[model samples]
Target chain A: MGDVTVTKSPDGVWCLCRLVRERLKAEVEEMKSQFSGFRPGLVVLQVGDRDDSNLYISSKLKAAAEIGIDAKHLRLPNTTTQDEVLQSILSVNQNLSVHGLIVQLPLDSVSSIDTELITNAVCPEKDVDGLSCMNAGKLSRGDLSDCFIPCTPNGCMELIRQTGVSVAGKHAVVIGRSKIVGAPMHDLLLWNHATVTTCHSKTLDLPEQVGRADVLVVGAGRAEMVRGEWLKEGAVVIDCGINHIPDETKLSGKRVVGDVHYASANQRAGFITPVPGGVGPMTVAMLMESALRVTLCSLTGGRRHGNSSGVVNRK
Target chain B: MGDVTVTKSPDGVWCLCRLVRERLKAEVEEMKSQFSGFRPGLVVLQVGDRDDSNLYISSKLKAAAEIGIDAKHLRLPNTTTQDEVLQSILSVNQNLSVHGLIVQLPLDSVSSIDTELITNAVCPEKDVDGLSCMNAGKLSRGDLSDCFIPCTPNGCMELIRQTGVSVAGKHAVVIGRSKIVGAPMHDLLLWNHATVTTCHSKTLDLPEQVGRADVLVVGAGRAEMVRGEWLKEGAVVIDCGINHIPDETKLSGKRVVGDVHYASANQRAGFITPVPGGVGPMTVAMLMESALRVTLCSLTGGRRHGNSSGVVNRK
Candidate 1:
């Protein structure tokens, strides 16, 4: 077993993340004592049998249990109706007990899903994932200091903070521009002081842009796509990709690798998040954090955790 | 007066500005056929004597008259009520005759303006200037295929298309991420296929980021802020800055210049929007285009002008 490299970053801001976590622990403890009636619950609906989705769900359930959130997992048949899926979401959306609802994606390619309708149907308050059309608008407008940001990207941010990298004034390169990861990631980085360039399949020169970054995030799911040479010296890296590759050495049929070749990149990375232990862990943690925050706010008459510091705890 | 640089940009794209003049001409010729109709009414509300606001409103009114649109101006006292100002917007919103309404901003310092409420209350369909919150949300969601876009930025885009510069796969660096320009500009660029980098006061290294642009748009309104030396060779520059400096030689007592030090910038630039003949005129033309589009959409069941290749009169 290889222990990952976990060093203090030279160029980023780690103390900020500590401050945020301190505030989170403090706020959650305070809420537990005072929020007598508060019980934050999150319901996740996953369909079919994708190993990735199952892994994501289990981690979320475990995180929810560890934090004081109630996470319920419901698996539906791949042949479920769009109406049935929407009904399940609306049920959780309306259930006062469930503060948030996340409908897991990759619905069978055979059965078309109306993403817009599902997103629009999510109650804005319980949109802890913050993927709803209304919440997306709030983020884009840069007016939502109180809005629930989507988990994975926000998790990337929490990690960035932990690394002690000041995003504001840094050159952050994002590989991929999907609505969930790259697009929202760019906006969040821009909000935090990073000048961001997003690249995708059509990007003219991939390495040139990557060469200029002070911080790099790769969400493009091509295994080992970002080589060690593509990084800026001492640049902080957050790898969000999870690709399963055949490995003869693995106990399982195959092993998982990230978008970057870990060993070589870690040697050059000032701070980097290892695949399974890094962003994957932070995402579920953030979701639990979001659900708990939502519960506290609803209990306190639609107000927030009220930490003037703008940091709240998941646990 | 020194002869100004004029790049007569070719029109007819997703930008609504190009269709305004020809649409207006057609509407005027048909005015007699529908005298009972509202004569395409437009009302503009002004709060103060800010020179720039005066210039913009005057240009709009001049263009409205030339097009035979019912042009009406209401100058409210600097001490206008939030309700009173809102009432004007309300009346216009309710008025069957009025097809478009504009509430000029930066209300006099003597009277605090309720900009948000004003923006929130305006009808999205008639938000010709495109500052309404509703329109903003729609645009950010990539829903502008049916919404009114802010005009000056739209005009900036028309210039690019006129140059036959393909937006797809290009990089756009937008300086000054204000609600009116930067935010919408970012979304619009994405819609058109340009990877966008947005910068504000908090951004780390200004010139370093600016130096890597394929297209640079400066809307900070700071005179000569972007030096000629900062631009990438052969890059197109759109200087949205309109500043007044002491000019003893001019009768107006001051002279106008753009954010770019144009003479120096023009030397290295492949294309640029000059202080007078560039974005300024194109903005009014776009507003007229928006009004005409709004009218046609209303008459034809809220159908938008067709996507980039909108209804255009070649002659």
Candidate 2:
């Protein structure tokens, strides 16, 4: 028996947690069937060993191994030249054995971010991360006819749907405009029929924007960046931030929490995904799903089992 | 020559409009110079005998020819098989002379909307219209790295920017989810940093969605679909609809109006782009622009004009 609401209209209950588990089960089985012996390889390139980035990669590699995927964490020194990074990416892109490639961000930056150079060599086919600008544009236009949507944002949607919030016709506001979360979140919401507003550092009156959202996804890293009073009544809240702030009572002297103050925000939020068990784990799981999807797609004539809503052609 | 807003932001008014105009003028002239005896070509595959579709195709062909772009309209009978229709598209798609290809919509009942088939067959490099699903996704994800954005929607944004409304950090609501306008408009808005919402027939409380928009774009076929009372104060409106409504004053007995009740909406709108002269002409113009862009892109190492804002360096 599931504790969440039925798979129809989201009244007052959240069930996406169960749905996510079910989907992971279904995808694992389906992918296994499609990929009998075709093990996929994932190359995660991280520059300058940031502790958080190291932890994220380590977890991703662990997830990959658990899912029977060949995953590697390619770490380079902070002093590594841009050409060296590009050359390493070129090899991963050119390697026929690799099915998915992801370059971890927050690259040792002093100048402008050269997204073009970093992702330039990534072949569109094995670009499971969808960091490539080409894929970003593809998702924006809903021309998913040949693009890998970024996994985390894509996973966020998948997780939200589990709570049974029908995205169609809803007003969704995504906080933060990072390429990884906010930008792609805007497109995904638009694709699913949610009227989307993306707020960032530049947006005036962030609270006013937040107040209008029927579905609010917060990804800004600052602790409790969104106040409880700003949330709309009965809104579905997805907290994607994993931040560490000093908490005097805690043993480690710091506590991890999401961008939204969950306790105060929960009074009005009809459905909320928790921090430690919420988007953090779902992201890694979804990347596995994407790697599997890449393999299945490369195998089966490009049409997936649940492609589109299958509503239009029913008539 | 410009009506600068003197009340709120004095430091902001720096002949920005004139400066942008000068830059665009130089770019346009630069593009025109590259046309040295280059004959652009557009091939249209029109299935069935729908009078409206034919008229639309003919006008596009005329526009193409007027611009020194060779245009051809091929008529395939209603009874033509899907394969035959597809083959005709292939011929145009493969021809090096045909730089742009458009398959007019509403193909007869016999030929299912195999629009996808025709679009898929056309090479991405020559997909000047950007109707291909692959390119559409690229636009949606805010990645213009290697894809051509859709013509009509691209035009809508240019017209909106032309109105002196800054899209960055504004709230924009787009009506209709048609691939042509609503979808691409949403992507363009996201790319420009406006929080965007997309509404369609399935949307609930549509007026509430419209009221939140700092920028409103209406493309639905229904006349007077958007009410003037729902508009936000000082909002900019762009009407893409071309509905024929009864007008006793007109000699033909009817007149063209947009999705919004224009006369009433304009009272509330700060700057509104008229349906007849506003976006309609620009759509055709953008198609020419797309053709120009793709031609230049194919010209080995040919860089777009000095300010190719089209590029998405997502770092």
Candidate 3:
């Protein structure tokens, strides 16, 4: 029997992430020299200090520091009011020094603050997280260059690009519909010229759908829900799910896994991304890229202001 | 073999359109009684007088008049500049009497007027055509109740709803991605809980993809492109393409057709919409409905302004 060539792409992701950061660093340095020490700034707005949120924020800050970005952690008390949160966001929106803003979500708050209102309050030009309706609309309508795509999907696309698999005319089946991951991923893939299918909890015969994918991206929160048997032979799989399950083998008592069953999927897949070493690092990396892009556009006076472009250009 | 039921839906569309007009008439009368002879007004701005544009405007005007709406045809000269068109649109926007406004598309002008700019200049609150990015953004985010959906897709959804087929969990294959028809149709279906696959010219194995659809909506603008043999048995098909092909048998030397080959499609489809009489009439009806809805909301002070809702609620 001919040997199956299953390419595991953890190293590929690390290299890609490193290269992006390096390019961003070089660009940021050039901008600083040209604009008289104009340092690109990003503000991470957190409603509460949950340990997980803190961990995410710290990693973002670390990446920003490495890229020579002015990264600030705007942490609010858990007992903060909705108006107070909005006030803080509005203040950041007006801050000339801050070019990018992201609200660390699942707002751990005593009071029920509206997350949508808070995220949308971030100026669209400064919405590096790309969760605002304006950015989401632009992305949905295939206005990729003008809009900020959500970080995780952007990272997933970058990974898919690295696989050297041409997305055009290929069937890409996305097995989630979450705004941050599945939904945006579907849009990104479709705009990239892939025939895209979006499967969700309501989807029937999901395995059948998955089996037809030339490229498969899964962000369904359930750990190891997608099986190896369901995947098409030589399919490129990008798993975005980060689920922690009890593991006696690990000292931390739990280990992170993806939506796809890695060992089994690896046996049949042509290219597969491992959970911890794959999409997670790329998501953080894409966030830095988005921040850098937003800063460059806004500071360089190339920002588009209310210019209406028709979303339907494919016809 | 038993008889295959093929429900041709031209009658249903006519009935739906009439009922909607009746409902709108009654509502306008009620509003007039309450607010001192207040009448809902709609403004259709036409830049130039193309024969098709004139025909479309006349139909819309006729529908608006039937609904007791104060319909005005703001026809500008063919030599009108982009700035002049913008000025006209902005004037209509500021007019408190005008509750709904639509710019008749393909602005047949001597100057190369920006269609996107002209369409978007109509204030979102008064944008009955629903071509504005603000409305498009809201619709994409599944804010169905708040956003004005583009007329054609909204009409198609109504037709599908009339068929008594539950969209939720069904496999819907949309064969085009035009903003006015296919793209919005996909979004509407996705939000309504259908698993949607969007296929365009880039789609390989198109027939195989078509065979899997429980529900199929085609707006590819190609005359009789989708054959019946490719369809899933008893699929609900909505054809939005209006194309004219040469027919020697007809006196006009041309006949209208849809994207689907209707004669063959009728044999397999449980429900199918016919061209010229199906989606065409419904689009006009939906435009009138949208205008009425916008007027009711704006004049009654129920319109929402500048609310930032995140598009990703599916998680």
If scored against the real structure, what TM-score would every candidate get?
A: 0.84, 0.78, 0.93
**What is the iRMSD in Å for candidate 2?**
3.1
Candidate 3 residues lying further than 4 Å off, grouped into runs, are A1-6, A303-315, B1-6, B303-315
Q: What is each candidate's DockQ, to 2 decimals?
A: 0.42, 0.37, 0.64
For each candidate in the order shown, give its overall lDDT on alpha carbons. 0.72, 0.71, 0.82
Pairs that clash in candidate 1: A12-A164, A12-A165, A13-A164, A13-A165, A14-A164, A24-A313, A168-A193, A169-A193, A169-B204
> What's the CA error at residue A127 for candidate 2, in Å?
3.8
lDDT (Cα, tens digit) per residue for candidate 2, span A93-129: 7887787888888786443447666874677777777
Looking at candidate 1, what is the lDDT of residue A125? 85
Give the distance in Å from residue A80's predicted Cα in candidate 2 to where it truly belongs.
7.4
Q: Give me the displacement of residue B263 in model 3, in angstroms.
A: 1.0
Candidate number achieving the greatest lDDT relative to the actual structure: 3
Q: After superposing candidate 1, which stretches have Cα over 4 Å from the reference?
A: A1-29, A45-51, A73-95, A107-112, A248-252, A302-315, B1-20, B27-49, B68-76, B83-101, B108-114, B132-147, B302-315
- List model 1 lDDT by residue over B234-269, tens digit each: 787888888888899999889989888988887777
Q: If you score just chain A, what TM-score does every candidate get?
A: 0.87, 0.85, 0.93
In angstroms, how far off is A66's CA in candidate 2? 3.3
